[model samples]
Target chain A: MTPNERLSINQATIKYAPLREALRVTADAGITSIGLWRDSVEAASLPEAARLLADSGLRFSSLCRGGFFTVPEGRARRAAMDDNRRAIEETAQLAAAGAAGSAAVLVMVAGGIPQGSKDLAGARAMVQDALGELAADAQAAGVTLALEPLHPMYASDRAVISTLKQALDLASPFSSSVVGVVVDTFHVWWDPELFEQVARAGAEGRIASYQVCDWKTPLAADVLLSRHYPGDGVIDFAAITHAVKAAGYAGDIEVELFNQDIWDTPSADAIARTIEGFEANVALHLGSLSGDARP
Target chain B: MTPNERLSINQATIKYAPLREALRVTADAGITSIGLWRDSVEAASLPEAARLLADSGLRFSSLCRGGFFTVPEGRARRAAMDDNRRAIEETAQLAAAGAAGSAAVLVMVAGGIPQGSKDLAGARAMVQDALGELAADAQAAGVTLALEPLHPMYASDRAVISTLKQALDLASPFSSSVVGVVVDTFHVWWDPELFEQVARAGAEGRIASYQVCDWKTPLAADVLLSRHYPGDGVIDFAAITHAVKAAGYAGDIEVELFNQDIWDTPSADAIARTIEGFEANVALHLGSLSGDARP
Candidate 1:
């Protein structure tokens, strides 16, 4: 793996920090790539935020979102699609400015149920329709839409795509080159088919990006943001990573943690710790696989 | 579905109540069938508990559980298997006396990480091995082993099988009639393949039992019990039920809730409200599907 296949930090890691500070901290920690969530980008003025990434010499791996299309007909549906269109435009703008790299993808979190409807299948259909429209926009802009399958627990209020296989199936009809998957370990580690899906995504060149974080048990719902760093939880990251590698996916391995505990720590400490955790996790993983290869 | 195929109450809904009180409340609520947890059965001696079930004339849908095979090899493994064997014997004893029906399966919640083991695959293998042993015993007793696939969030410590597909796959190698699956809505509602798996389970004659409850967003881990009653949350229960029906499943639809809030309320009220919620949910769901059907 080359430096290009190294780590990217999701801005949500230090969501409390100003975007500029987060970028500087990421760069200082020697991670040259970053994933910027849409909410944070929206919080900042686009052009100004674009300048920060440019000046910092950081690669935007993905523009963090564009999908919440599970809305009832009429105003809600139109409004969601309209908002998504704006998000696509923003992603394109970031890519043009080198903030979001030319190769950077637009990450999507498929929305949950439409209010007043328990028809999850209908909502899923709406997501597919919304994705089709967004994919068209993304294609025109040379941006790949990376569908992130959230944890199943969030199927109701968050992303409806809760498994990598499900996400790939949803994106299958679309051109895999333009619409792909974001394999986030935190969200998918519990999936029994994680390795198979990761391999499948990689085989089709549909692995838009790879993200890592640990899954803690006895998790608090309110600690929605609290994630253990990679190697600190029960997930078999090494096996999944090996599967991804076996599939020939050579892309940036991003460390995107949404943890209140990690966020409350100093930015310097958090970024430094993340980098170390990444190194340790990968090293331990490789060592275990290679029968005594050690860092 | 006949009265024989009507709803059963899983006593874990009133797990907080004393066994006698729980039985009384369930019988008074006109729930002719009820399931009891292992701890609750032990709390009230097995013979006494059998007598109570006999007196109330409520059939046991399933024995609440008997599986922790993931524990590392040693005394713990021996103990878990032994305990499960005892549970099977108890289930048989109850069946022989006509306290529970001959078809009452033992629902298995496969245990999570054993102490000092990070090998999820290994733990899963251990679970399979344990089930292999228990399956023979269950067959001898004429009781089926219902593999209950829990929500992925509980994958680490509660159940490794987090999807219906995974559960069905695990039980497939065994005789479909001997080893089966319990389709609990709370555990499987978030599953994208819920409908497909239900059809498969029913087609294979592996639908040992069907359970229903709702998944509350912003789930609390401690009072981890489900708070969302049927129709109170986002799951499309009607579609799932309809699919099961179409697939030739004619088993009791068990109402199993574990809400702390509901438990604190009057047990009688909880049972009544649960039944009402079930009816309302069925009506609302059927009405929605029919489109022209009025309230």
Candidate 2:
């Protein structure tokens, strides 16, 4: 009954580490799970990356991304869907397919508004159409497309889906086994409907990943990499974790921070902080704040 | 019939202009309304500022701000409440003291999460409690506390109220005559619940002010000043303006750009661009998009 049983270190938190080296350090620290970007896998060759993850004795929590459907229909859009199909193939290789939490999810970051267009509605329509088209391929491969709704600030440039409710609605058309969403704290902690949405996501069995991180103030120059470790900022982890857990979630808690400061640290030290932050700020408070014992 | 009838140049958009100079140029530029920040009023002396505004024949749209209740109870909180009473008095002097978008609004930016505290709920509760204490004073002065929900990025340090729905809900206990909400495009364009919320605010007779500005991408270093003139960014002004107009709003559409670049421009040239951008991107589209004809 290790407290770190559900812990997973997303490699993005320490991009400075080589893939094999990151895995070695994660294992050395007695970590049991991981989430990886497709770029890392591609850099090492998919076969080698998969072999490395399999040898590390760590659960493959999810793959980084698969959607950028904002491109206008034509060659670019077709290529995106083809790329996602390949991503599904990779998820299948991870061999954690299931209808429940056992499945390894392929995270979908619905791309930003297309170039030279202010048509947010048109961009969103493309995401829905892309999801509907890709859902069958994902189901056929027995892997899930983990729809991720980024913060609204990223709406015009990163993802049109900016709320858990929007993500859930987009996934509603697809089966739970093929489509779900990432409940990433940095993107959704400020949502007024968070508790209710988390409960709904749990009931629908669409909570594919629950990523934790803090939102640092005076956001870094690169807004994308401004996330801090949990407890380092203002998010109330206890309340959110309680809501997610109460909604029947039992899965790995992944730390996927994107801060440049965190990236500069050696992987081992960063891993240590991630573990400490998770256990102290997140894991310790999950069941307690809800006034219910851990399931 | 001038197309810019409802246009009002908020002094923040022309940061380079002195108070009297801004008023004079606004008058010369054929503008009929202006929104004032208390800092500027304090700088010129309230009596002198009021005399200038009254003499210039400009409609005083609203006052800048009055809420910072994130400071916990005791001395600091009492000080915030006292400041708000002073603001209400000034709003009364603005002489736009009636609802239906006629009254001068005492803009309220609910304070950010308190120092060293991750409790967003607690901060929001403080705002509500503080509002309850000040609503009577605002009502007595015939000024509305126009609650302004800032963008979520500012949730930590500017305002906890980040949506019109949340602002309206927070003001629900008070009469709409005393408590209303602002419709600011820059702060709320990413909101999925925007149209519904705008309609609801109008239905409740609580649409106190409508502020227009564009959210530029690659946000400037100072996030507070990243706003652009209308049509300079990706917000669908025609769509939002149509929705607000359809909701029975007929009042000055205040241009409140906060960009350093805009502020650096010569006040007259910047003010000219503000008017042009509003007409092209907002005003011109409003009556046409709504299809009922401008009332």
Give the C-alpha miss distance for residue B230 in model 1, angstroms.
Answer: 1.5
**Location of the lowest summed lDDT over 10 successive residues in candidate 2 chain B:** B95-104
> Measured by TM-score, how close is model 1 to the native structure?
0.93
Alpha carbon deviation, residue B24, candidate 1 (Å) = 1.7
Top lDDT model = 2
lDDT of 1: 0.77
Q: What is the C-alpha lDDT profile of model 2 across A203-244, one tens digit per residue? A: 999999999999868998778888998889988888878877
lDDT of 2 at A21: 92
Would you estimate the TM-scores of all the predictions?
A: 0.93, 0.95
lDDT tens string, model 2, B1-295?
2438788888888876878998888878888888888888889887888888777788888889789889988888888888889988888886542223345688899989998988888898999998889988988888889999999999999899998999999989999989999999999988878888998998998988999998768988778888998888888887788888888788788999888887778888888888889889887865543463211
Candidate 1 residue pairs in clash (backbone atoms < 3 Å): A225-A258
Task: Give stretches of model 2 more than 4 Å off.
Answer: A1-3, A96-102, A286-295, B1-3, B96-102, B288-295
Real interface contacts reproduced by model 1, as a fraction = 0.67
- Worst lDDT 10-window in candidate 1 chain A: A286-295
Task: Give interface RMSD, every candidate, in order.
Answer: 4.4, 3.7
